[model samples]
Target: MKNAAVMHPKDRPEGSEHNECRALGQILDRVGDKWTIMVVGVLSRGPFRFNQLMREIGGVSHRMLTLTLRSLERDGLVSRTAYATIPPKVEYALTDAGRSLIEPLRILSNWAIEFRPVIEKARAEFDSRQV
Candidate 1:
């Protein structure tokens, strides 16, 4: 009854499209790092210095945090500033693009937190069945 000759993309508009492959790869690189998500969440509240970030994100090593921040800065998601102060203060802040990702991250975190009990139970059952 149907002549299905064309296989059009269902999710994209006829003329409007994007580089989804590149976008997915870059996004995965961002969220793939646990510390990056934590750092983004921390900075979403506002800017903070190196020490403040260290304090906010518990258990994050100086090296790892520095690396994560550098990655984010390179990706244009975060901006870093340095001041010629007595202690030579440096601070980190999120760009507009980074700020826009906060809601999605919050949603992801909430889902993980809210589903923890169910997820744990499922894992337990799965492990027991495998035994």
Candidate 2:
């Protein structure tokens, strides 16, 4: 049998599959983060200032929220609005691109919920075998 690792000349297109996989991995790393998912889900309700976000997303540290917001802002998934005022107010909201992610994340959330029992059983079985 021919080796699976060897790609035929015709398979080498202008945009290689490896590059596409790398790009997908980068995006997944960001969106798949626990804090990112929670932030996106909460922000889907509306824009929120940093303190409000911290309150809404329980258990997230102040530093982690700041980092997550900065990362989301950098990815164009979230927008930061700053207001000129005595206190210099700021809010974070999902961009058009970020809003588009909501449905997919919801679907994934549902799948995880549905599979939790089965996954727990699997884990129990695997752990039992290790003893």
Candidate 3:
């Protein structure tokens, strides 16, 4: 993490002796939400209007998407632009800080897809023992 500005404490391996390694829990609290990942992933491609985002990311309600974008914008991970038009035109894009997240998020997404089966099996085994 010497070269990086941000280091997620969750990414650290176990058995570390530094108790203060858990300092960036706020970042995790913000970006670790399920909606944030998907929204950011979509925005990483390019700017999108509100309806476009809702369509691209199916199953997210209008209110939820609005809230997600607002939170991301507040956290400096997303930018919102409104154009002066007849009615109004709005778009959302990733800020520089948000762009920095794309690579790390891509890596994490790959890890999730790759390990899903193994994780599911582990969950089943643990669940069986609980009964």
Candidate 4:
């Protein structure tokens, strides 16, 4: 008896492409997040302490920044280092993998900047049509 969980890949209709897309979607969900993008952009400059990151990124709440850092760390894109001192200090920096993301992100950023007026005009047209 073949268990559904153990079913062969040949048994699946969507096959490997579906699985590949699902994996890509999960990664996109992480990297495509606004906070993640902002954090990555700031970190690309250099390492930053927690408070420094908050100040530099602006508008990120304490908890949100903490969560975003944790998520980035979990994905191995960012590294966290702690120092022993009277007041313990920690800093966050990008790993090589994270650094590799900068070029693609920069291209995407440039594209968005270039198309902003066009997008805004399209949105206005769409909104007017909806009325």
Instruction: Sort by TM-score, best first.
Output: 2, 4, 3, 1
- Model 4 has an lDDT value of 0.93
Full-model lDDT for every candidate: 0.86, 0.93, 0.88, 0.93
Badly placed stretches (over 4 Å) of model 3 are 1-23
Candidate 4's residue-wise lDDT over 17-101, tens digit each? 5776788899999999999999999999999999999999999999999999999999999999999986999999999999999
Question: Per-residue CA lDDT of candidate 3, range 1-131, in tens?
Answer: 44223455556544442544464676787788889999999999999999999999999999999999999999999999999997899999999999999999899889999999999999999999999
Candidate 1 runs further than 4 Å off: 1-23
Candidate 1, residue 33: lDDT: 73
Question: Number of the top candidate by TM-score?
Answer: 2
| C-alpha RMSD by candidate, in order | 6.3, 5.4, 5.9, 4.6
lDDT of 3 at 88: 99
Clashes of each: 0, 0, 0, 0
Please report how far candidate 2 places residue 123 from its true position, in Å.
0.7
Clashes of 3: 0
Tens-place lDDT per residue, model 1, 4-119, is 22334564554333555567777887876799899998999999998899999999999999999998998888999999999899999999988987998889899999999999
How well does each candidate superpose onto the true structure, as a TM-score? 0.79, 0.88, 0.81, 0.87
Per-residue lDDT tens digits for candidate 2, residues 1-131, read: 33323667456665566776788899999999999999999999999999999999999999999999999999999999999998999999999999999999999999999999999999999999999
Q: Is candidate 1 or candidate 4 better by lDDT?
A: 4
